[model samples]
Target: MDKTAIKKFAVEARRSLIESIRLKAATLGITADGIQAKLPISTGDVEYYVDEQGGISGHDIVKRQKLVAELKQRARKNDLATAFNDLIEEVAYTWFNRIIAIRFMEVNDYLPSRVRVLSSTENRNIPDILVNVRDVEEALGGFTASEKAIITRAEDTELPKDRDAEYQMLFIKQANALNKNLPYLFETTNDYAELLFTPSYHDGVIQHLITDISEDDFNVAVGGQVEIIGWLYQYYNTEPKNTVISMPKSHKFRDTEIASATQIFTPDWIVKYMVQNSLGKYWIKHLLAVGSLQNESEIAREFNWQYYMPDAKQPDNVQSKIETMDSSLKELEIKQLKMIDPSMGSGHILIYAFDVLMQIYESEGYSRREASESIIKHNLNGLDIDTRAFQLSYFAVMMKARQYNRRALTKITHMNVYDIPGTDDFKLEDFEILLSQLSENSSRLLRHFLQEFTFGNELGSLILEYSSSLTSLREELDALNHNQLSFELIPLLDKVADILNSVELLGQKYQVVITNPPYMGSSRMESHLLKFAKKNYPNSKADLFAMFIERWNKALVSGGYNAMVTMQSWMFLSSFEKMRVNLLGNYTISNLMHMENNVMGIAFGTAVTIVRDYQLPSFIGTYHQIKTADVSGKIPQHLPIADNRFNRTNQANFAKIPG
Candidate 1:
C-alpha cells in the first residue's frame, strides 16, 4: 500500500498531460484566442482544416465536426483563458483516469476483451490492440460492424500516417468500446475529453505509467490497486493545492479552488474507526434489541472491527432513552439501513462501509452476490463536488461489487455516488412561458427550487435551505404526466423533474452521516460562500469543516450516528464557543478521540467523533486523547500504547466552564 511511487508518477503525469493536451489542441486550430475549425471550401468530397490554426485533411469529417462543437460549447461558459485552461484540465484528467483504469482492469483480467490496451503481452513495447486490431472481435466478446469500421477507418491512407496519430486514434476507439462495460468511468458524450487524449505508449504519460510503476501495484491480489486511485487523485492535484496555499489572504476561493485547497485524504484506520463504530455499532445494537445476540464483544471479535468502541456507562434515567432509540431497529431489514458520506472524496469511507455492510448481510444469511448488489444500490451512498472523485468512487464501488459477483460490471447497477450539479444559464421566463399550463403556486416553487441550486456546486450537499419546498414541488411534478403537456413544455418539464429528483436524493436523511468534509476557514472562503455560511450556519461559520457538523446533523435522523474526523479547535476555541454550546446542548458525544498534533499528519490537531443526533445529557461518552506526538501516524497501532489517554467524560459538564 506504499504510495511513494504512485505519488511521484501522478504529479509528473499531470504536468506532462497538460503540456501534451495543450500542444494537441494547438494543432487542431484551437488556442486561447479562438478556434478556426473550418477552412475556405471543400474541394469535391475532401475538406481542408486551418491546421495549427485549426485544420483537418482527414477523410472523416464527423470527428472534426464533433471536436469543434465540443470546444465551442465549453468556451461559451467562461472567459477564453479560463475556458481553455478548464478544457485542458478536464481532458487531461479524463485521459489520466482512463489510462489508470485500463491498466488496473488489464492486470486483474477484468477487461471484457481480454486485450492489453497500453502494452503488449507478446511484445511489451507495442500495444496488444494495435497488433490484433482487425482480429479482436471474438476476443471482444461481441464487437459490432460499426466498431470494426471505426478501427479500419483510423488506418485509412487519406488520414495522417504518423505512428503517434495512429496510436491516438486506436487508443480512443479502445476507450470508447469500453463505455458499454464501464459507462460510469468511460462516458460517450465526453468526446471533447477524447479530442485531447494525446498521450501514447511510445512516449509521454503512458510510457512512465506502465514502465515506471510495477505491475504488482495494479494487481488486485496485491491488495492496494483500488486504493491507489485515491492516492493518484490526491497527488494529481498537488500543484493546484500549492497554488491555492500560496495565494494572498484577499483571494476569493472559487468552487473549483475550494475543492483542491481543502481536500485532505483520510487515513485508512480513521475510515475504519468511523464506519465500525457507526454502522457496526448500529447492527450490534439491533441484534441485541431483537434478541438475536447478547454480548457485542463476541461479535466485535468475530467481525475483527478493532476500532468498534463498546458503549460506555449511562445514568439510570438516560438508559431508557437509549432503549427507545434501539426499539425502532428491532425489525429493520438490512437493505433499509442507509449511510451517506456527504463530502465523499475518493470514497475511502464509503468503500470501507461497503465491506462492513457485506459482513452484516452475511450475518443475516444473504449470499455474497446478493449482498454485493444490495450494499452498492441501497446501503452505500456518496457525494462530492469533484467529478473526478465521483468517477473514481463509482468505479471503486463497482470494482468491489465485481469481487463478489463476477458479472457485476455488466449488470448496469445504478451507482449512488453523485457529483453536485452546478447551475447553468437559463432564463426564468423560459420556464414561465413553457409552464403556463401548471398551477401558479407550483410554478413559483419550481422557480425557487432552481434558484436554490444556483450555487449547488459551490455549496455542495450543504445546500439544504429549500429541501421542504423542493419536496413539495417534487410531489406536484410527480402527479403530472408529460402526455398532458405541450411539446415545448415537455422538455422543460423533464429538466425540472430531473432537478427535483436530484435534490430529493441529496436531501434525504440517513442513519449514519460519515465523512471527512472539506476544511476551509471563513477567512479564506469566497465572498458568496462566506455569505452563505453566515446566513445558513451562523454559529459554526468560522470554518468549513465545523459548518458541516451542523449541516450533516440536519441530514441525520434523530438517534442516528453522525461521525466525522475534524479539527479539534471547535471543542476549545473561544471563537467557536457558540457552536460548541449549540453542539453540547443539543447532541450527545457517543465517542471522541482527540489526536493532537503530528497524529495522522494533521498538524493542527484532530478529533474523531461519533455524535448521536439526540442528547443524553447524563451519558458518559468514551474519549481518547493522544498527548505525545507520533510521526509514524499509525493510529490503530499507536492507540493501544496511548492507553493512559483513554477516559470517560460527560459533555454536559463542559457548560460549567466560566466564560
Candidate 2:
C-alpha cells in the first residue's frame, strides 16, 4: 500500500463521514440536549434525567416528558446522521468480513472439507453465512411470533423510499449476526451502531470503496492500518470544531480524539529491532540453555542478535552466566512464550511480534497451522484504551492468522487481545462484590488497597482465572449449550471478565514486552488520567510514555525482555532522575539506539532501548547513536552498529554517566 495515499484517503473519508453524519443529525434535531430529554416516567421510576428548559420551567416533569417525546419524534423523522454512523460502522465491519472471507477462500484448499464449502461459494449468501447473519431468524426458531417479529424487524427490513433506513436495518442485522457469530469482531456493545445511517451503500459506492483498496494492502504484519487510521483520527479531531453546527459537543473531544492526538505508529524496522532484541534474544538464550547452540558466537550468528554479548576479554564468563541462568525450558515453549503490547494502538507491535514468533515456532519444527493457532491462542496479547484500536488490532491479528491457517477462525476460540476498561460495560460495583469476598471485616481497608493496587497482585490473579473461565463458558454457550443460568450470567461475567483481564494485564508477567507507548506530557493528559498516573507512578508521571516504561517493567517476569521506542527525554531530563535510578537498579540495558530528531520522519528525538528484567552485575551491552540524516527512513534497518556513521559505546559505561 502507498502510505501517503492511504493516509490521504483515510483523512478524507473520516471528514466526509463525520460531515455527513453531522448534517443528518442536524436534519433530525438530535442534539445532546435532545437525546438527554426526560422520558414519560416519574423521577422515582427513573435513575436520572437532564432538563433542557431554563429555570423552574425545566422542572415541570410532565412538560419535559412531552418535549422529549416531540424531540424524539423529530429525531426519528430527520436524524439520518446518527443512523448513518451505524451504517458506516456496519459497512466497515462487513467490508472487513468480506476481506477475511475472500482471503480465507483463496486458501480454502488448506481448510477442512466441511469448512471449505462455506468459503468456496461466491454469492453474498456465503459472506452472510460466514459473518453469521443468514438464517438468524431460523436459529431463534423457538421464540414467540411477536419476539421473532421484533428480531426480524431489527435484523431484516426494507424501506424503499428511505435508503438510510434500509441501510440501518441491514447493518443492525449484520452487526448482530457478527456479534453472535464472530464475537471477536463486534465484542461488547456495538459502539458503532448509532453513528449514522447510509441509504446508498449498496448502490455501487461500497463496491467502489472496496475496489479502491486491495486485500493485499491491508498489511497486518507491519504498520499499514495503524499509520492510516492514526492519520485519519488526527485529521478528524484537529479539524475545525465549529464547521458543522450539527456536530455534537461531546464529539469534539472524545476518547478517539485522545487516541488520535497521542498515537504514533512505530516503523516496521523499529518493530523488528524491538522484537529481535527481546523475543529473539530470549529464544537464543533458551537455545543455549538447552544445549541447542554450541557457543555464544554461534548463538549470535544464528539468531542475528547484535545486542547482548560478553566482554571481548571474558568469553568464558558468558558461558558461565548462561549456565547459571534459569534453565527452565517451560518459558521457552513457542506456544507458552507470551508477548504483549499494553499500549497496542492498532497492534502494530503485536502484529510484528506474531511474525517473529512464527519464525521461532517454525525453527522448532512446528507446522505453520499449529504455530498460527498457538500464537493467537497463547503467545500474542494486546490492550489499547481506544475501541477502534482494539477493533483494528483484533482484525489485524486474526487476518494475520488467516495467512497461516485459513481454518483458524473456524476454531471456536477468542483471541487474547482486549481494549482497556473504560470502553466496556464493566462497572465499579462489579469489583465491589469480589473485594467484599476478599475482606468483609474491613471493607474500607480493602477498598483503599484495591484503589492502590495497580497490577500483578491477588486481584490480577483472580481476574486471569475469571477471564479464562468466562472464555470457556462462552465457548460452551456458542456450542449450543443453552443453559438458562449460564446465559443469564454471561453479561455480568463478560463485564467482570473484561475488568479482570485488564487488571491481570498489568499484574501478570510476560516473557517479552514490546510497544511504542503513547507519548504525551502530563499537561496534555486528561485531568483524571493525569491524576491517576500521578498517584500510580509519581516518579515517571511527567510523561505518559515514561509511566508506561515503569508499568512495562512491572509487567515483565524476572529475566523477561522489554523493548520500546520512546521519546529521548527520560535519558537526560532532570525530572526523570528517580526513574533512571530505578530502571538501572533493576534492569539490564541490552542495546540502545539513540536516534537524532527526525531520524524516522518523526519530529521528536527517539531511542530504541532493549532491557532485560533482571539486574546482573558485570553486564556488557551495546549502544549506538545515529547522527546522519536519512530522508528515506530505511537507514536504521540497513546500517550496522559497526558502521562508522554510528557512535558506538558500551551500554554499561553509558549508564554510569550522571543524568
Candidate 3:
C-alpha cells in the first residue's frame, strides 16, 4: 500500500492490539490506575507533523529529530540491543499486570458473585459481567444488612466451604469464554463497548453455582492457565497485518567496529543456501517416512492417535508414528539444532528453521499435521534476549504452525517448549528408586536410563511395563503435565529442563556454528542479566552470540557444522582473543563471506563463516576463498562438504585487506 496507508494501518493495528490487551486486563481486574503509570495509552499521538511554515514535513525530518534525541540519550551506551530491551520491559510489565488480575479473579471467585461497581484496579471482574449481577442484586434491594455483608465477603474473600471447585472452574471458564469471544458476542471491535455490554450473562450462572455447591470441592486454577485466555483472544482476533514505518535514510555511517562504511541489510541468500544444504540428509529421512502415509486422512488419523489418543493405537499403529519417528531420527542426526543471531533483530534464524523443517516434511509426503509436529517438537529452536525478537520468534511460529493446523494458530502461544516430558525432571518413584539404590551400583541404572534418552536410545516395550509401575503417582503426574503440580516441580524441572535443553545444544558435533551475536563490547555488559551471565559463564567469554556459540558447540557431538552471519569485526577484533582461540583451536575455518554493508539495514557489517568441528587433514584453519555468488544465480558450494581447498591460511588477518 501507499506510505500514508501503511502508517494508518500500523497505527490502527498497534492501537487495537494495545487496547485489546488493556480490556483483557480489565476483565481480570487491573484497573486503569493499576497500569496507567506503567502503560498510559497514547490517545492523541500525532500521525504526521507539520513545519511551522505550514508545509507538511517529510518523514526524514521527523525521523532524524527522534534518532538524534535517542542517540544523545544513549551516548554512553555501546549496546543498541540493550536500549531495545528497555521497550521489552514495558511490554512485559503490561502483560504481567493482566496476569495478576486474572489470578485475583480466579482465586477470589469460582462462581460469579453479585457485581459491585468497583473502582479501576480493585481486582474485580470486568464491568460487563458485574453490571448484570449488580442490577439483579439491586432488584432485590431489600436484603438485610447481614446479607449485604455476606455478599461483600463473597466478592472479596475465598469461597465458602460449600462450593464445588469443578463448577467454579466451569464458571470461571464460562466467564473467560465470553471475554475471549467478545468480538463475536458483540459485533464490535470497540474496546469499551464490549466491556460495557457483556456482564448480564454471568449474573444468573454465578449466583446458581456458588449458592448450591457443597464445601469440599474447591480447587485452585493451575499456573499458566490464564495463558489460555490470552491465546484465545489472539485467535478470535486473527488477521494478517503488515506495515513499514519510515525512518530517516542513513547518511555516511561507519560501524564503530567495522571501521568501514557500508549500507546494511546484506541479502542472506548465501547463508540460507548453505544451511539448507547442510540440512539435506535430515530432510531426506523426513521424506521417506511421510511417503508411507497413504493420504492426508491417514496422516490426520495418525495425528489424532498420537496426541489426543496416545494409547488408542495398538502395536500396529506404525502408519503415522513411524513417519514421525523416522523424521525425528534424521533430524537427530543433524543434532537437535539451535541457531541464534546475536544481533537478532527479528528471528530470521528460527524462521529459517521453520522453512527447513517444513521442507523436510513436505519432501517426505507427510501431511501438514506430521510436518508441524516435527518442526515444533524436533527441529527448530532459538533464543534472543531481545523481547521484540522473542515476540517475533513467537509470532513466526504461530504463523508457520497455522499452515499445518488452523486450530494450532490459536493454541500455540509461547514458542519456547514450555513443557516437554523430561524438561521438568519427571520424578517417578522409579527415578528416586533408581537413584537411591546403594547396592553394587545405581550409577549403571542411571547411566542406562539417561543413555536411552541420549544417542537415540529407546526402551521400547519395556517403557510400557515400567510406565505402568508408576501408577500410584498418576494423579501427581497428571497434575504436573497440566501445569498444576506441587511447587516441588519448579526447581526439579528447572534443573531437568536445563540439562535436557542443554543436550539439544551438546549431542551433535557441529560442522558449523553460525551467528551474528549482539556486538556489545565488554564494557557495556552490566545489568543483572549480564551480571548473572558473567558469574555463571565467568571463564568462558560470553556476549549474546559467543555464549550462544559456546552452548551450541558444547551440545555438538563432533564433526557437526556451524555457520553464521555475524559482525565482521568479531573475526579480528582485539577483545575477541578468547573467542578467536576457541574458534581456531577447535574448528576448521573454511570460508568467511564478508558483507561490505549491513545485515538488517542496521549499522553493523556482517561476516558469514563456515566452520567444521573436526579438522580434516588438509583443511584446518584455512580460508577456502570463493567468489561471491549472485543471489539470483546458481547456489554456491552451499553445504561445504565437497572436497576442495581453494586457499590455505595457517593464520590469516581478517582485518587486513584480503589480497
Candidate 4:
C-alpha cells in the first residue's frame, strides 16, 4: 500500500461520511440554524464546552435546556436529524473498530476457540460479533438457511424493504458486547455505544473504502488506520462551524483536535534513532558493567561508543570511563527497566522500544514469548491525552506482542499504557477534602507525595498490593482500621493509591524516555492549559514540546537517557535560554542532529537531540547541523550518525551560553 495514497483516501472517505451525516441532519430539521437559535454561537464554547465548570455559564445551561427541548420536539414529530448526527459519530467510530478487529484477526492466529469457530447465528459464546455470516461461512464452510437468515438480519440491506435502521442498532449492540471482552483492543467503556448505529453509508461504498488501501504493504496493520483517523479528526476541526451540526460554535475544537492538528506520524528511522541512542546506550552500559566485553575492539563494536564518540583519540580513556560508571543491572533488572513515551501517539515510540527491549531480553536467554509478556508487563509505558490515540497505541502494542506469542490475545492482560486523566474526573476539591481530614504531619506528607513516593519504594509496594486487591481503599480501611480518622481519610488515600498505580505505569524515573511531544505554541493552547504550564514549567512554558523536555528530564533516573525530535527554535531562540540552561545543568547531551527546514516532510526546522539525565561535568557532546540544501523533504532512513559530518562540541562551553 502506498501510505500517502491510503492517507488521502481515508481523509476523503471520512469527509464524505461527515458530509452525508450533515445533509441527513438538515433533512430531519436538525440544521445548524435550528441549533443556533436555541444556543448562542460562541467560539469560546466550542473550545471549552467539555470544561463544564470552567467555562459553562448559568445562561449556557438555560440554552442547553432549550436546545434539548427543541430536539425533543423534533423527535416527537418524527424528525431524526438530531439523532442522525449522533449516529454519524457512532458509525465513524464503529467503522474504525471493525477495521481494527479484522486486521488484528488477520495478523494473530491463536484466537480463543469460541471466537475462531464460524457459527452463522448470533453466538453469545463468541466475542467476534462483528464477523458477519459471509465472513464466517467463507472462512469455515457453508451456512444453513437458518444461518443465512441470522446473517441477513445482522447486515444492512435495501432488498428487505430498508432494514438499515434495525441493522444499525444490532451492529452497534454487538460491537459494544465485543468490546467488553477485548480489553486490549477497546477501553473499559464504549463511550460511543449510545450514539452509534450501522451507518446509512452503503455497503458497496464502505467496501470500496476498505479496498482503497493495500494493507499488506504497510509496516504495521494499525498504522494506516491511525494516520487516516488522525487526519480526519484534523479535517473535522477545520470545517466551518455551520457545516458540523453536532457541535456548538463555541466548541469548535474538541480535545482530540489538539492531537489531530499536532501529531506527526514519526518516521521509522527517527524512532530507531531515538530508541537506539537512548535505550540502546543504557543497555551497552549494563553490558560493560558485567564485563561482557572481552577486549577493547569488542567493547567499541558492542557499545557503538565510536558512533557517539567519533573524536576519541584514546580507547583507554573511553574504556576507563565506562569502568567507572555504575551499571548494576541484573537480568531481572534489565527485563524490568521501564521506558515511556509521554506523548505516545499511536505508540510508534513504545512499539520500537518493545523491539529493543525484546533484543535485550533475548540476549539473557528469554524466549520470544517470555520477552513479549515481560515487555508489556514491566518495560513499556505510554500516555496520550487523545482517546483515539490511546486506543490505537494500546492495539498496536498488543498486535506486536501477538507476533511473538500466538496466545497473547487469549488472556487479555492490561498493558501499562493509559489516556491522561480528563478534567471532568480529576477535581481539586476532592483531594482538598481528603487533605483536610488528615493530621498536620500527614497533610505535609501529602503535599510532597509525587517527589517522596519515588524514594522509599512505597509506590511500588502500594501498586503490588492494589493490583491484587478486589476492594477499594474505603473498603480496605473499613475492614482493617475502624478508627474515625482513617474512615474520613479513605477517599484521599484512595486517590493517592490510584496516583501511585499511575506512577508505577508512568514511572517517576525510567531507564529511557523518548517521544515526539505534541508541538503547540502557548498562544494555541487553551487558557487553563497555558496557566498550568506556566505554573509547572515556568521556563519552558512557551511551547508544549519544550515543557515535555523538562518533564522527561524529571521523569528519568540519574544517568537515565532521554531522546526526542523537536523544533530547533529552543536551541538558539533567546526566549528559551533559561530552558536550555536548566537542561544542560541537569543533563549531558550525547548528540544532536539538527535540520534547518522542510526536514521530515514538514516545513518546520527540527532537531533530534539525545541526552543522558545526569550531570557529567567533563562530558563532551556531538553536534551535527544538516545544511538546508543537503536535505530534501524527508529525512533519509539511513542517515549516518557516526560519520565525520558532525562537529564535536564540548559540554562545558555549550552550557556557558545564555542563548
Top candidate, metric TM-score: 1
Q: Is candidate 3 or candidate 4 better by TM-score?
A: 4
lDDT of 3: 0.37
Write model 1 residue lDDT over 508-620, tens digit each, in one string.
88889899988888989867888899998988989988998888887877778999999888888887888878878888888898886867665678988888888778788
TM-score of each: 0.90, 0.70, 0.42, 0.70
Off by over 4 Å in 2: 24-29, 36-177, 187-195, 199-208, 211-216, 219-257, 295-319, 326-331, 423-493, 634-637, 642-652
The lDDT values for all models are: 0.77, 0.56, 0.37, 0.57
Candidate 4: 10-residue stretch with minimal lDDT:
457-466
Clashes of each: 8, 17, 41, 8
Q: Give per-residue CA lDDT, model 4, range 1-659, as digits (tens).
A: 36566555655656665666555443323454444322233353331332223233344444444444535533442345644444455445435545545434432332332343211124232224244434434333344575456556656453443344434433443344445435644432233222222343234224434345554433244543223333333333344322433344344333444655567777666777778777877776676567785433454355333333332332465445635655545342676588888778778778777877877788789999988988988888887765556677887777678767876765546788866533222344546766554556655545445333322211121111112232333243335442654543554565465454454455456888898887766766655566566887888888878887887777777778889899998898877889988888878888788977776667788998888876765566777777655555544545555355776666788756546
Residue pairs in candidate 1 whose N, alpha carbon or C atoms collide under 3 angstroms: 29-53, 29-54, 49-55, 49-56, 50-54, 50-55, 51-54, 51-55
Cα deviation of 76, candidate 2, in Å? 24
Choose the strongest candidate by lDDT: 1
Tens-digit lDDT track of model 3 for 1-659: 12233233333433443554444434332333321111232123322222222121243234434433333333334333433233222333223222223323334342123232221125344333332434434223334565456445556663542123222322233333323322112122122222212222123322222222211122222322222222222221222111111212232111221111111222345436435433432233333444543333343233221111011121244335434444444444322544433223334455555666565466557777767765666565553332323343344454456545644533443344211122111324434533342233433433343444321111110111111122222223233452554454354434344334323333333333444444433333324435544654443344444554555555343544566555666666655566666665565554555544432334445566656454332332433333333222233323232344234443334324332
lDDT of 2 by residue, 297-388 (tens): 67555656543342233246653663576576534677668888887867777776787788788888999998898888888888777656
What TM-score would you give candidate 2 relative to the actual structure? 0.70
